[model samples]
Target: MRNLRITLIFSIIILTISCKNKEVKSENKNSNIGQFRFIISDTLAYGKNLARISEYNRKLKENESSVIAVIIENELEDGSTKIDTFSDGLKTPFFGISKYQTGKHKIEIKVEEKMMRTKKLPNDSLSLEIKDIYYTYKFHVFIKDKVYISELNEILSKQMDIEYNENPI
Candidate 1:
């Protein structure tokens, strides 16, 4: 009888502790958990532009969030595709160490201007054009050593679309 009472008391204490600061988790895709984001210079990413690209990769390492972005072509209603990114963050040269973020959260960004791209021609003619962009993603979250997880692949992440120059130069 004493053992049963002790076990019941202990279980209540554990349940009460677990209720604090609980994360909203779900296994569904619409569960709002798997979103992640990062602001990477499109110039360095593509093989086209070299002049505007910095040796900055060797000089300075960005405080890059661990979100791998998979951009796809945006299909328009007219059967034309456009890169439709509009960024509202501070348009600054990508620099400085970003702040550390909590795991399983996503980055949300508001855009003040639509993002665009520019091309320099062989005869020094500059062709400026806007790209229609769309994105899909794969997720990877770095869990700390002491953390526990009931599910791994279903983990979600997010980041703000800040510090990216629309047309890098």
Candidate 2:
């Protein structure tokens, strides 16, 4: 009987440690900003002719889709800023362009709850399920040279930060 009691106590301690490890793994997964690829095809082109190309992959539920929210701030030669905001999905490669030509540009990309897609269910119903899914990502890029593609690509590529977050509901 004494041996049985000791065995049970040891098993309980092991079980507790296992549970704690699982919890820690969950937290790490939530905080992880996975990898992505971003390239500016025409980095050396004029500001208005420049284009952005990127790709990111994520597993989503049947009722869910991936989206990207972007904010672009371009500083003109006269010291004024042009701001643009738009949203797009990640099911395919992302291609985008800006309409300004001179000065510097700051680009910010976010992937969060607000990027959620709203779709009607088969029976025209809506349901919510609480799941342990959290994704948060932020990517920043700066464009300074709008003249030579090779040089600008080298400079802008060095300034790219391709982290993003996603916590879907």
Candidate 3:
């Protein structure tokens, strides 16, 4: 009986995985993906720590689908690099353009979220706030070139319902 139960459970799990993959493959054939590209034009290398704060302002409409969140990383000296992410409802996205940066850094900047939480407020709350967790970003970054942080483009974004508290000070 024990062996039979184990085999049955294993078979069910395998079947579930195959079913989900099939659905995703069919969905992708009709998906319309949006793309945003920026070119950083700084190529001078120096020895020092660098840090900069930036903002992300993109308005996601009701039920507007978003692709993967992009990560911009500046590899540091101790095998550690500064990283920032851009995605839907990313409240605060701060980066060091290269903080305490020991050397010159890369050409892109993305914001970091200090405090991001999704929870239902009290029943007596007066506001209809929707804190939706769309999905964890599929991580990808291009090691293009080294540049200063000032060249980042600033744009206007919409307000979100997610409660963001911390400031990256």
State which candidate has the highest lDDT: 2
lDDT of 1 by residue, 54-142 (tens): 11121211211111112223334354544433212222222211112223422222111112334458985544332222223322322
Q: After aligning candidate 2 to the native by TM-score, how far in Å is the CA of 150 from where it should be?
A: 6.4
Question: Residue 11 of model 3: what lDDT?
Answer: 35
Error of 3 at 76 (Å): 2.5
Best by TM-score: 2
Worst 10 residues of 1 by lDDT: 45-54
How does candidate 2 score on lDDT? Answer: 0.37
Candidate 1: clashing residue pairs, number: 17
Candidate 3 per-residue C-alpha lDDT over 23-130 given as tens digits, one digit per residue, 9 for 90 to 100 = 111111111212222222232223222222222344554323222233456555576766654443223332223333333432433222221112235883222222
Question: What's the alpha carbon RMSD for model 2?
Answer: 17.8
Candidate 2 C-alpha lDDT tens digits along 1-169? 4433433343333322211111111112122334344454322344542333354556665554333433345445565766654333332223334434434433443322221333456885543322222232333334435454555444444433232223221
- Reference-based lDDT, each prediction: 0.25, 0.37, 0.30
Ranking by lDDT: 2, 3, 1
